[model samples]
Each structure stands twice: as structure tokens, then as C-alpha cells.
Target chain A: MRSVQIPISDETIRSLEVGEPVALSGVMITGRDAAHKWMVDTFIKKTRQPEGDDQQVYAALKPILAGGVIYHCGPVVAGLDTKDYRFVAAGPTTSSREEPYQGDVMRHFNVKGVIGKGGMGPKTLAACQEAPGAYLHAIGGAASLIAQSVKRVLGVHKLDFGVPEAMWVIEVQDFPVVVTMDAHGRSQHAVIEAQSKSALEKLLAA
Target chain B: MQDLTEPILELVRLTSTDLPADVEQALRQAVEREAPGSAARGALETILKNVALSRANSTPICQDTGTPLFYVRHPAGWSTRSLRAQIESAVAQATAHAYLRPNSVDSLSGKNSGNNLGGHYFPTIHFEEVEGEALVIELMLKGGGCENVGAQYSLPHSQLGAGRDLAGVRKVVLDAVHQAQGQGCAPGILGVAIGGDRGSSYYASKEALLRKLDEPNPDESLAALEARLTQEANQLGIGPMGFGGETTVLDAKITHLNRLPASYFVSVSYMCWAYRRRKMVWKDGQVSYS
Candidate 1:
């Protein structure tokens, strides 16, 4: 198996090949359904006032504090400021939950990398191609131990949404993630499902 | 008969934020067993690790602190004043102590129930009358990601294409799981409830999930179906986290109702890797661990 560390960058993300297992290391932001909605409303859609100016947003259902990786996690977080704590349960909601808002967030935030348990839907791929960004699929249900690897939780924002669904800003190093969908419009999720179905048909015939 | 309001509430509190002793032990052992894939195995290890962190630091195991779902089977013919309130109070108490992240959000107003209370969507409790004098409660922290994958379908009675047979039901379930893909977090447990009306099917599915992983299905046909589904689903190669490989489903469970010629409804619920659920059986005057 080929393993390589890719730095978080807009152009690098645009060139990723399909089905390439990637280990991501770089600054990544955490945003989920609530946060995604917030970003769109506040920024692009302008339904809600802008929280901040242009930046890269990760479609993370949870966030981990480790060396320098952005986990696609939206953890159930409690507390505020430095005292924040995350539990290792199902904080990572479905990545599809943010399908409608991902493309907008990428454009508005200038996000280079996105980490989540599941890859995003079609709109996201279109956006990724137009922008400098990629969707990395991390193994789902690895929340608890993954939290332990979080070297340091840089800071947390948006406590108003409650911990389980809050938008967290965390930093990590050498975080494990696979490049499922890259900026060049390649998607591993679609490829694998097709392959798996065909393989199952063969097994059934055999 | 004693008023179980306070005690039941206490049990709810303890189970929600704290991993009961048996659950803790069981989880620790599961990690040691070490599921196949590095990621699946790693996920279980993290669960055990989180239990340690939670127990030591008194942090809630997961932030979802989900809707405190309780399955309580108490003595038959026993009735009390305001059972729901008592349970709610217990959830509130446990939520406070567990340091559970406030997850209950007011649907109409879209505001967080700051104390993890007040929301209609949380602390979902189901009650049943059983042959015992005491109350047995199974508390599950049902996170939204996993909960979203739950499916309830009404299949018209027939054979072949006429009705929902094994193949038809299998197709629905397979599609349900496949549609869920990585969203519900695979390598998960699927709770299937068949042969009931809409509401009963839903309840039956949830009840089926309470069965222990190793316990054999009571009905031979359903049990056989359960085993078959488990094998078939894993064969889908959904694997842990839906990445690929074997070990897609940890277990599959089925519970059914003896139905007439009416429509058959099948409901499926998905439990993600961190299946945080515990049981407490009441005994004597003192509340003890399960």
C-alpha cells in the first residue's frame, strides 16, 4: 500500500487521485450541519450575519486536538474556552447532513481540506473542482481514541449550539484520513459502492 | 409498592454520564478481543479509552449525551403518579452530574436546552409491565447520526412480488444500510423489527436492540433471518466505517409481532460503534448495579 503525507493546500488538493489512501496533516477547521447552516446563513446566503470573513471550513462533524490534522468530526463538546471536553461517542453526525451547504462554505471559507466519516454529495464535488479543496474520509466510529490523539485543542468557538453539535476549532498533527474525494472531482465512495455491488453479484452467482 | 420516582431518576442519572460497572467491563473486554480491521479495532479501543477518561475525569462518554432513552419493565399491575416526570427528573440529575454536553434543542424556537432538559426530543422513555416487583431500566445514549439511519417501512402482504418476503425484506434492509453507507457509521449493529403496524414496529425494533449481542433470537425463523442478514450485510464489504473489507455488521437482531392479514411494517435502527447503553435492576430497598 502506498502511504504519503500531503500538506493542506488548495492546489495539491485539486490533483488527488481516486482511491488513494491519504494521511492528512495541516490546519483544518471544523464545521457540521449546524455550523454549515450558520456559515451559509451568515456568509453566502446572508440570512444570518457573517461570523467572520473568508476562511477554509472543514465539513467535520467532530474536531480533534492533535499534532496538526483536522478531523472530520463534530464532537458532542461541553464547557467553554480552555476547559472544553469532548466525549468519544457519535458526535460525528452524517457527512451527508451538510450536503446542501458544503460548496458554499468551501467558497466562502477558502477551505483546502475537509475531513469527515463519510464523503459529501454531488454539489460538494462540483465545488471542490471549482475551488482548492478535497474531502477526506476518516474511519467512522473511531471518535474516542481519536480524541486521545488530539495533541492540543487550540481553541473552541460557537458554544451557543451546545457541545454535541458545536463548531470547534482544533489543531492536530499526522491525523489519519483517506483521500476519498479530491479537488479534481474524484470520489472513492461512489467507486467503492459500485465495485462492492458488482463483487456481491459475482459472489451470489458463484 | 414503593414510589420509584427518586430511585429510578437516580439510576437514569448514573447510567447516562457514568458507564455502569458491567458495561465498563464488557467494553474493556471487547477492546481486548480486538476486532479485525485496524480502524474497527482502533474504534473499540477508543471506546474503552474513553470509558477510562470518562470514569476518571467524570466527563460524559460522548457529547451527544443523546436523548436519554430508557426501557423500563416493572411489575405488572403497578401504577404510579407521574411516571414520566420521575424519569425526566432522573435524566436531568444524571445529565447534570455527567457533565453531558447539553444536546436537547428546542425544536420550535431552535434554542439549546441549556441544562439538557426542556426539549421534547430528549429523554425518550418506554415503559412496559412485566412479571417483576422492581423496575429494570436500560439506558441508551442514542446519538443523532446513528438514529437517523432508523427505517420504518409498511409492506403489503403477499408472496414473491406480492408481499414482503425474505428477499424483499432483505432488499429493503440492504438498501437501508447501503443508503446509510458511511453516514450511520458502519461496522454497526442493526436492530430489525418486523410484522407489526407502524408504531409497534418502531417499538419492536428498539426493543430488539436491547437484546444482548450473544443472545440467540427467540424465534427460529427470525433468528435465522438475523444471522443471514448479518452475514449478507458484512459481505457487502461495508466494513468498519464503510471503508471496505469484512466485519461490516457487528450483530443483527430481529423482533416481530404475531400479525393478522394486515400490512407488515419493518423498522430498522442502527447503533454506531460507541453503543453506550446500560441496564440496572432494582432489588431490595437499595439500588444496586447490574
Candidate 2:
């Protein structure tokens, strides 16, 4: 296992290898399908304008996005009625759902890591190589254990998108993940899929 | 006739925090089956520990408390309208108390109700007028990850070489399991429906999941098929969390439905191991839970 802090540098991300376990710390932003679409649309809109750029649309998120990690999660938050938010359970959602938007989102935001489970596809893998980022696979269904790593809820964005789909800014310590796709262009998901398919055929033959 | 709100709330709490005994036992056996210190074993260990902590702390077993599915059997002359209203109230209370994650969302508007209420079919309730005099409710918290991997096949599948026979059913069902790999949180359970229209097939597939993990299907042939599928899925080497090991699927359940000649649909509902479900029964003015 390796220890990695957030706001990860491209060099650091590039050094990570696929299938290695990691303990992540520092601040990470959370988003799912809705937030990914919102971020990508904002990026496209900003780039199209004469005076606009990626930085302008993402200005507010720049501090958190620059060389940082984006976790694909829909945490169960508490204290909504009191206006004080707490994560009761935090775990990775399936990452394939964001495959279409994640590559561009990483490029636009200069994000160095994407934390999720159920690994993504070719587009995401290419994005990781292009952006020099890594896709970290958190253990699926290990919600309470993962919640233990989240130290605090810093803030939130796009709450109207729904609590599960909203972008939540949080601080974490020793959050566990496996590097399923790394900056060097290797992906455990692709490998596993191929191997499992062959195994299925063999089972059928028997 | 009694106020069922509190009892329903308790049911939600129990379902969210506790792994039913049968599921825990299945997981325990899987742990022993895997090679010691392997990644699959380690993942299962963490999950087992998480289950214990969630129960002790009364926190949700998984972050995605999932879409709450309610199956209710009521005596004649009872009002489903009032029961639904009470269920909605209990679900909201469960959210506020953190027993459930707020999951009700408007699909088009992209707005969360925040209280896990309001949206159409949000806390899905299916009501039946049974011959029994008791009011029985079963709630299953089916999470998003596993739900995403569910598949439906129109039989005579050219791609998979599946025909409109039991062999085709096995082929398609296994294909679904293989495609799921580790994405649906492997060491999962499969609930399969062999026939029905598309929608009804999907519904029956999910309904099949309501059966207990250890319970055998009454149909002898179907029971044997279930056992065989479970064994074959595990042999795929897509162990716990897809990390590779002895167990990919803990159980595979099958239900047969009559279908039209033109449409032979097979639906598969994959469920993660969190498997949060419980039942509550009210009889003779007294309430008890399972």
C-alpha cells in the first residue's frame, strides 16, 4: 500500500501503478452523473465564448480542482435540517456512468485523480493518460468504513441536483482505494473483463 | 388499525443497519472458501467488519440506501391509500434519522425532495389483498451500483446464441453475470425471471430477490438450475469486489413467468451483498418484525 495526499501532482500520479492500493488524504471533491454533465456543459459553454476560458467557468472550483481528486460518490449526509452537514456513509458509485464526461472534466479542471469503483472505459483511460491522472477504485459497499476516512464536510455545490448527485467538497484522511487505471495507460478493468469473458466461455463448454 | 408509522420506521432502521442472518452466514462461508490473505478474502473481511460496525452504530450498511421497495399484503377492507401515506412518512423520518440516504429525485427536474418523499413511485409500494388477516410489509433497500448492472434479454438472442429454451435462459443469465464482473459488487446475488413482457419480466426479476438467500425454490428443476448457476458464476473467478477468488455470486434465484410466443424476455436483477431487507407483521392489534 502507498500513501497519497490530494492536490496530487502530475508527476506523482504518473508514478502510481495499476493494481496498487493507496491511502488517500487531503481535500477531494465529490460528484456523480448530474455534476459531471453540469461541469462539462459549463466547460464547453465557456470555451465557446470569445472572452471565456475553462478557468473562468471553473474559477470558483479552481482551488479544489487544480491537481486535485474528484470522487464519484453520492454520500448519505446527515444534519440537513440543522444546516450542519455530516456524512453518515460515503462510498464510491459505479464509475462507468460518468465515462462520457469524465475525460473532458479532468482536462478542463486539471484534476490529477478520479476516485470511483467499477472502473471506467477507454475514454476515461485515455483521459487519465492525457491529463496524467489516475482512476482510484474504492471498495464498493464499504460505505461506513469509507465514511470513517472523511474528516469533515467543507462545502457543497448544485444541491438542487439532489443530495446524492450534488457536488460535495470534503476533507479525508487515509481513504483507501486501488489504482485501477493509472497515468501510464494501464487499466485493471479492461484486463479483468477480458479474463472473465474467457472464463465464462470455459464454464459454458464444461 | 394501529398506527404503523413507528413500526415501519423501526423496520427501516433494522433493514438499513443489520445484515440479515442468512446473508451474513453466506458471506462467512465465502470468506472461508477464499485463499487466506488473498485480495478477495481481504475485501470480504472489510465488508464483514463494515457490517458489524454499521449494526453497532445504527448507520446505513451502504451509503446508497437505495430505492426502498415495499411489498405489502393486507387484509380485505384495509386502505392502501392510508398505508402508503404512513409509509412515506416513515421513510422521511428514516432519512432524517440517517437510517436511509435521501434518494427521492425528480428525474426530469433533477431536484431531490431532500426528505426521500414526493416523487412518483419514490418509495415504491406494491399492495396485494391476501387471504390472511395480518398486515405484512417487506422492505428491500436495493442500491444503485447493482441496479445499474441489471440486464434484460429478448430471447432468440443472436449475439449470445441464446434460443427460447432453458439452455438459452442459462446462457443469457450467465452472460449477465459475466458482463457484471466486479462492477456490480461481485459475490453478488442474481434474481432472474425467465419469461414475461419486458416490464413485467423486470418486475418479477426484482420480486424474485425478496426470497431469502438460503430458501430453495419450490420447483425442483428451477432449484437445481439456481444451484448450478451459482456454482458456475463463482467459477468465473470474479470473486469478492471482482478482485478474483472463489465466490462471484453468493446466490442465483429464478422465477418463471408465462409469456407471449413473440416475446420471450429474460430479466436479471443483480443485488449487492448489503442486501438490506426486513419484514414487519401486524396481527391481533400487536406488531412484530422479522
Candidate 3:
């Protein structure tokens, strides 16, 4: 597995081969359906869109801050009186759930990397190519453990949208992730599914 | 009964937020036994490390936090009192303390459930009476990804065509996984609940998943089927995170009941690589590890 830092370039994006595993360390932004819609509607369609160039937008519900990696995770959170609260379960939800809005989010936000579980669809693959970004698949169901690596809460915003599944700005240190999708439009999830299905058909015929 | 109020509340918080003892052990064991290759192994190792970090840092294990699914095996006399109210109260408290993302939105209007309590949010409790004094509670966190892949089909045994015997059951399962791709976060598990009608089949799948990862199937034929399916599924090279390699499936479980001749229904549920479940037996009005 190769480890790379952020400012994910077009060259790096294009070089990413299908079926290659990569560990990423970089600055990442967080977004989900609501946030994606917000970006697309507000930025793409709107006349004045803020600066978004080569930044990563994690399709995450919650944000973490440590060394500097972004995670595609949505957490279950409960607030105390107003501020103090706890994160119950912090695991990866299926990234495919956001496939419909991911491309637009990436383009609008100028996101370079996406950290999530499962891989995105063809449209997302196309966006990764056009936007010159990457998609990383963090292991699913390992949320509790991932929560530990989060050095600090950093900052938590987006309470009105619901803290756990809403868009939160988080800073993490040395957060871990694997490249399941690259800017070149190659997807590990797609290849494996095809191979496994082919193998199944062969076995069935035999 | 030890005035189960406080203890029940504590258990809810611990199970939902913290990794229980048995679950930790099972997770470590799964990584050791199932994961093969650098990527899968690295992922599993990281997962184990995360578990440790959550314990030390007091963070929830996963963000999904999952909808609480409780399989309660109660003793004969224990049913005299209703435990639903106690459990629900505890769930509410735990959700608050655990900081679980409030996923429950009003189906009709898409409004938040406010307190993780919708039609059956937090703990989806299933009750069964056993011939014993203490109650056995199997607590599992069922994530949405895995839950969505769960499917049910009612078919006559004879309708399974020629290739679809017990072998066909295995084929269909692999196909289901293939169809799901990595959407369910595979390098996962398959639970097949065969026999009975539609509803029972669904319950059976969930129940089968609740069984211990290492435990052998009770029925000899079923156990053999499990072994074969596990091996074959892994051979497909779905790998950890569906990257490709010999670890797509950690295990396959099959549970069947003697069925009526007319129709046989089978249900399949897919679990992500992280299968979160723990069993605690409450006997003699007390809770103990299974």
C-alpha cells in the first residue's frame, strides 16, 4: 500500500490504477446529501460560488481532527443540555447511498478525495475524472475504533442539520484511509464485483 | 429481579456506545481468523486498534451506531412484568449519552424523530421464552447497509429447479452478494434462514446472524453447507472492503426448521465486515455474559 499526502494532483489522480490499495493523508471537507444539495444548488446554479479547488469533501455525517485526514463517517450523537454530548456509534455508512449527489458535490466543492465505504457509481467515477479527484474506501463497520484515532473534536458545526448525520467541520490527525476509487475512473469495487460474478457464473455452469 | 432499572440503563449505554467484552473478543478473533492479505489484514488491524482507542477515549465504536436489535430469551415467570418500558427508557438514555446520529426521520414528512425513537427505533426487541430462570439478551447493532441487503423469497422446495437444491441456496447467496457488490461493505457474512413462511424467514436470518461466529451449526447437514459456502464465497476473492482476495466472507450460517410441504421460504441477510453483536444472559433476575 502506498501513502500519499494531500493537494492530490491531476497526475496522481490519473496514475491511480484499478485494484491498487493506497493510504491517504490530506485535508478533507465533509458533506452528505443535504450538504451536497446545498453546494450544487447554492454554488453551481448560483452566480456567486465560494472558492473550491482541489479540496476533498468526505461524504461524511461527522467530522474528526487529528494529524489531517478526512473520514467518510456518520456518527450517532446525542447532545447534553446543549453542548456536552457523546458519540455512540461512529461507523461508515454505505457510500453508494450518496452516489446520486456525489459528482455534483465534488465539482461544486472542488473536492479532491472522498473517504467512504463501498464505491460510488459511474457518475461519481466520471466526476472523479472530470474534477480530477479521488475516492477512498475506509473499512466499514469499524467506527468505534476509528473514533479513538480522532485526537480531538476540533470543532463541531451544523447542529441545526442534526449533529451526527449532518455536515460538520472537523480536523483530524493522521486519519487512515484506502483508495478504492481514483481520479482515473477505475474502481476496485466494480472490478471485484465483476470478477466474483463471473466466477459464480462459471461455477454455476460447471 | 434486581430492580433492573439502573442496570438495564447502564447496559444499554455500554452496549450501544462501548464495545462489550464478548464483542471485542469476537472482533479480534474474526480479524485473526478471516482476514487474508495486506489490505484486508491492515484494515482488520486498524479496526481492532480503533476498538481499543474507543475504549480508551470513550467514543462510540462506529458512527452508524445502528438500530438496536435485541433478541431476548426470557424465563417462564419473567414475562409476568413488561420490560419494554424499561428497555425503551434505557435506549433513550443511551442514545443521548452515546451521541449516536439521529437517523430516525418521519417517514411521511421526513422530520427527525427528535429522540431516536420512531416506530421501532433504538432497540428492536424480539422476545422468546426459554425454560430457565434468567433472561438471555442478545444485543446486536444492525447497520442500515447490511439491513438493506436482507431479502426474503417464498418458494416450494420443488420449485428450486435442478441446480437449486441446498447447493442452489449457496449459489443464490453468492449471487446476492455479487449483486450487492460492496454496497453492503463486504468481506462480510451471509445468514440464511430457510423454512417457514415470509415473516419467519426474515426473523430466522437475523437470528442466524446472532449466532456466535465460531459456533458450528447444530444440524450436521446444515453445518457442512455453512462450511462449503464459506470456503466457496471466500474463494470468489471479494476480499476485505471488496478489494479482491481470499476473505470476502468470514463465515456463512444456515438455520432451517422442519417445514410444511406446501411452500418453503428462505431469507438472506448480509453483514458488513464489522458484525456487531453480543449476548448476555439474564437469569435468576440477573444479567451475565453468555
DockQ of each: 0.35, 0.72, 0.51
Candidate 3 structure, TM-score to reference: 0.83
Predicted structure with the largest TM-score when compared to the true one: 2
The TM-score ranking, best first, is 2, 3, 1
CAPRI quality level assigned to candidate 3 from its DockQ score:
medium
* Residue B79 in candidate 2, Cα distance off native in Å: 1.0
In each prediction, how many residue pairs overlap at the backbone (N, C-alpha, C within less than 3 A)? Answer: 25, 0, 37
Model 2, range B1-290, lDDT digits (tens) per residue?
Answer: 56799999999999999989999999999999999867788889989988998999889889999999999999998889999999999999999898888888777776788888865588999999999788999999999889988999998998888899888888889999998989888889999998899999999999999899888999998998999999888878888887778999999989999999899999999999888889999998888888
TM-score of each: 0.81, 0.95, 0.83
Write candidate 1's Cα lDDT for A1-206 as tens digits: 33334344554565666555565444444667676777677657877554442243333322231112234455644334348554333334567877898777666656566677667788988877877677776655445445554555555566566655555655444555667787777786776577667755544443
Residue lDDT tens for model 1, B198-289: 77887778778777777898789878888888778777776656656565666788887865576777788887755667777776676764
Clash pairs of candidate 2?
Answer: none
RMSD, one per candidate, in order:
5.1, 2.3, 5.1
* Best model per lDDT: 2
i-RMS for every candidate (Å) is: 3.8, 1.1, 2.7
Error of 1 at B269 (Å): 1.3
**lDDT tens readout by residue for model 2, A54-152:** 354367677899899999999989888776999989888988999999998888889899998888999989999999899998888889989999999
